[model samples]
Target: MKITGSRGAKALALVALVSAVGACGLPRSGPNKAEIFKGSVLKQGDAFIVTVNSRVTRATAVTPALGFSSAFRNAGVVGSDVISPGDVLGLTIYENVKDDPLLGNTGQRVSALTEIQVDGAGYIFVPYAGKIKAAGQSPDGLRNIITKKLDTQTPDPQISVQRLAGDGSTVSVSGFAGANGVFPIERPTRTLSAMLSKAGGVTIEPAVAIVRVTRGGKTGSIWLEDLYSNPALDIALRPGDKITVEKDTRSFVAMGATGSQTKVPFETQTLSAIEALATVGGLNTGTADPTGVFVFRNEPAEVANAVLGRRDLKGDQRMVYVLDLTQPTGMFEARDFLIRDGDTVYVTEAPFVQWQKTLSAISGSTNAANNIATTGQ
Candidate 1:
């Protein structure tokens, strides 16, 4: 370990060069504590950085409310047996005459009429009954109308009408459903939950599955599981309604020195900071600075005002929340802190990491110099 003046000076020179290069730049997962603070609102930066506290956690701990609007909730259950236009009706006529029957041959007192489709104008035609409105009329109501129409023509005409298949009282189901098709809305499938069951239920995980209902140009969505927990969410189905079962598209970006950096999806309806971190495999034990955990989000003006206690900020405000896991209540705050969709969770590297990298560079440089000198000798 004894080095002469020239060799010692050369080593010192190499160390200085490495230190200068390290000071200039070093690879990092993301901006460290100092760099992040430099971009704070106080520093005239775009982001407003605030330390995570009980108030901050409470202010930001919110998930989107997944439920139906008044239009969807206020809709009353429809009668599944009600007739509508485009419906197929099966009719059978019974005659009391022993001689000549209006709809059958002599001695034959019965006549069958299959596929009597209701027109777009809600009219259905029987042989002698003429055009009769069938839409909005129940099967029995239509039967009575037909009998009355044929009363003056046939001998005590009796009629029976039955609903067979139709494009009217049916819903179109698509997306993650087990069976994606148009299903008839019958007595058993009159409600949202029942209709979903008729479609073979959702194929995705229920915890994150979303059911969207579109009716008359208005759309409402709710968590598929919420349909059971909240009875109001299971609204009655209507004809021409479109239903889609989709997986939750909400996700957060995981970056910096923690686990893996990618778009982490929401596993549950509501996600917290702790859960989000866990989803990304937690922090990198060696490089992650426990005190430099941060979350970046663009919050609405209303939420920004509540969090920062300011009313002047308008539009979407850039918010950066700092979490010091080393504090006594830090872990609790993280557990309570909600991670909204499109948020980012980042952890800075420990300060000593840069120094270690600098030292490694210097050692590598010195070894290379020594090898060159030995080779020359």
Candidate 2:
């Protein structure tokens, strides 16, 4: 097209403006595939970039293996009805002799001791039984011992011992349980799962719930859902054990051209790359480059070696894995690929998105120039 008069000058100025915008580069969601490749360790960058493939997917498909250790699983269940220190025992003694009963008056043949508490030293003192070891003995066994101890003092002494309000043989259940309190260990609540039930079960979703058992100085954790599926994980509970039901704390970050950029927590026990994308609202359809999906993570040396097929890498290695959804098996690879905690899932913008932005800037400049040219006319 031929331009004349002041219009020609405005046209030239418009061309210059467009050139300036292109030279400065248009704003974009993130670096494109080529730019990302330029940042690879092979190209003097800090990250070792690898493409997502079936082999890579298999190598990186590991999830957090959470379960009770042998220390917890091998523990045998103790008798929940056994007496322990700090337990309160209710005792009632009956004497056959009506004349001058040792533990009762002449006319009284029954003596009721409603509050006999086992001391910290595992001993309980009765009126005529002296200091007797009550801990580790069942209620019936304790009754027999008390009866024997008072046999010499009273005639045909018969004692009955009943456990009332145990304080020692108990577990403390807290954190996301339906009820948070110290629960006495009974026959029905001797195992870890049973103790959790005695506390009214976990209040949160089982898939994301974590059950932790802290006994003595060691702590073991397991997924709540696994407790039922794997009976071996339903470890036996011990006295003074503390059980806590908590939500899973694993999370990943979504950035770049994704539907939303935020730190998303794992809703299920195991999360894959595709599921993680869905959790963040998926990719930005208009700007996202389906071939430029990237996951950034600091992998341990062993994982890094397996993924890279190299054993030279040491410590935690910075790795970037690329996923191309445009490929035939790309979707399957993404579906199989696992997303771990603290990973960053980024989707770069399509190459044409930047070109489109540049065209928009040129369109604006053309309008401005035309208006100026019209005024000059």
Candidate 3:
């Protein structure tokens, strides 16, 4: 059959349409279009950077400064003294009497009476005396009171009183310790580091250890790193002060064009989004779509709902946060966009570029097959 010119043109057009359709239908390269659309908006846009400026604001609640305040309160000054129960008092007696049995027994008698404890009302129960308020009383004041009381019973009774326990003398150790409990101080002077050693030092990684001290109901935090460098911050330990050691375990998210796109452990205190990108070995230039780099972060559903004035988000619902890195400002923002633990970053591929890859792969396969056929023939 002789083909007419018009008929041949129609057939060629039809073949071309079929080839075009086949090329379009070939598996798309890079990220799937559907997947990119499903991802957060940030992943679908160009990459940009934004700079972050920190603003100073007064702390509304207890902060690191509050901790320092508590430390100062714990360390009692000259006039303001802190007295606890079970504190020991020392006493000496002087009497000029022949064959004084009372004087001979004075040492043992004073020892027993000095060990007496102060009641919850801050009053001590002296053996031969009634309740005596000792909470705010100085050692010498307490001694004078005792001497006056004893003088009424015995003529010219000489008495001396002194506090055996130092003011501010108890230490408490909690969290990540072999034996987590409070310990009594036997001596007057003790350092913060010494108390920590006594309570069994941190068992967890030093880098992850956080030490907090609470005194007089106030708290202060000291990082392990700072404690090592600044000896001044390691203030002397006082009685009734609590030392808490906690372990920090939050990680960072790594996304974009990298060997592995997943969450990576971030042990440091702060992790910038750019640093996270570098951690994953940066973007894969060959297959990466620089314009479509983004980070998808889901805010706490409750927090998002509260901020947006919406009802409770479903259990599976996520608040999508899109970050574009194509613009220079976007890059600055990425640097400031702190990559919190468990955030997801996505990098999308260009549609046209993916189409080219698909067609290239198909053409390469077809050419290889034709070569094989020709060789076989």
Candidate 4:
């Protein structure tokens, strides 16, 4: 990290904190004093460029997002769009001939359909079979179980079970929606993107959304951009599952020599430094110190220290991120540099410009002195 002024002291302190990262988990001070970084000069490799997984590490849940995965684990049942526990199912038994007390001999081969509620236990009580596990089980599984149970009493007994209510035909969608509720699924139109559309679609752009699925106590998450890009992940929704959509909080701040210095929210959950730079209107070619573009962020001391090529130093540390954008591979490397939330990005004023301004001030002062003498004469 390169520092030109009193900021060098803070930069070294941060470097020391990372170098000492191995010594222990020393509590570091927060950036409460604006002066610590208010006018601090930054270089390309300061402790701030992000290299972790989460898009926004320093984000304080600013417009924070919440998400969940589907509630069923079985890929089989979940895929087939079958009903699970907490759902209503309808069943019918069929026999070859005459009226049987079990079938109530509807004269026809098939018995009347009966609707039953699947309890929280995922079990449904059949007339003769009593309570049987139904949650996460497929329609075929239910049919086979019921058939086996009645096989002994009747000759070649046949049974049919259909998912009446539950994940079988509906999925609950919530968040940033025109109407949040369970949407009935149309056959062949049960994918996530399709389901969201069925609910009148999300109000915000899905590409920038954070979506999660909670299923079987296990939750999975992905950005809407990824979901939209990957067709396979929009898996079938199982009964008893919930999906939540939320606005993306992942963002970064652009400061120093940019067209506009401001906080820029990521258009998509995942973005690169180059993309981030582009989003903020790039640097001011007229005044920006090209070599001084830097990103500032707090990072895991151990990891930061490891990258800086040293052993534990002391205290806590935030990184001063830099890149030699002039290099041929600069753009490629920048593309790999992921920007996190609350990250401070700055483009230093060119050294030549600063010198020129100083010289101009000196020349103006001399001219004023000469002019005062002439006026007095």
As a whole number from 0 to 100, the lDDT of residue 87 in candidate 3 is: 57
Give the TM-score (vs. native) of candidate 3: 0.58
- The true-structure Cα RMSD of candidate 4 reads 12.6
Taking the tens digit of each residue's C-alpha lDDT, what string does model 3 give over 1-377?
35688899988876675477565655533454356555543565432122232210011111222124544534633232335555555567554443442434633333234555566667776555467887667667887787677666555666666666433346778897556876755442366666677777788877767788877766787666567676666666666878888776566565545656666776555677677777787777766665566554455545444534567564423543344567767677657656666667666655565556555765787799999999999
Which is superior by TM-score, 1 or 3? 1
Global local distance difference test of model 4: 0.65
lDDT of 1 by residue, 1-377 (tens): 45688899988897788779787776778788999999987898999999989998888877787788888888888887789888898999999897988888889998999998888888888888898999998899888888889999977888888998898888999999999999988889999999998889888899999999999999999988889898988898888999999998899999999889999888899888889889888999989899999999999999899999988989999999999989999999999998999999999999998888888877787799999999999
- Determine the C-alpha RMSD for candidate 1 after optimal superposition of all C-alphas: 2.9
Off by over 4 Å in 2: 1-19, 375-377
Measured against the true structure, the TM-scores of the candidates, in listed sequence, are: 0.93, 0.93, 0.58, 0.60
lDDT by residue for model 4 (1-377), tens:
35566598877865564445423432221221232344342543324443322233223113334333333222532345355556778888888667554656546677656678888777888776667888767789889988888777777878888877454456678887556998665565466667766767668987677777665577776677677777666766655457777787767888877778888887876677778878878878887765556777766555455655557745546766665577676667677776767788777666555445554554666699999999999
How many angstroms is residue 222 displaced in model 3 relative to the true structure, after the best TM-score fit? 7.3
lDDT of 1: 0.89
- Number of the candidate with higher lDDT, 2 or 4: 2
Residues 1-377 of candidate 2 have per-residue lDDT tens digits of 55576798898887787678878877877778898899899999989999989888888878888887788899999886798898988999999888888877789999899978889989998986789999999999998898899888877788888888768798899999999999998889999888888889988889999998999999989899889898989999888999999999999999999999999989998898999999888989999988989999999999999998998999999999999988999889889999999999999998788878887988887799999999999
Give candidate 2's whole-model lDDT: 0.89
What candidate 3 gets wrong by more than 4 Å, as runs, is 1-81, 88-98, 101-103, 106-114, 119-124, 135-138, 154-169, 176-181, 185-209, 212-242, 300-326, 349-377
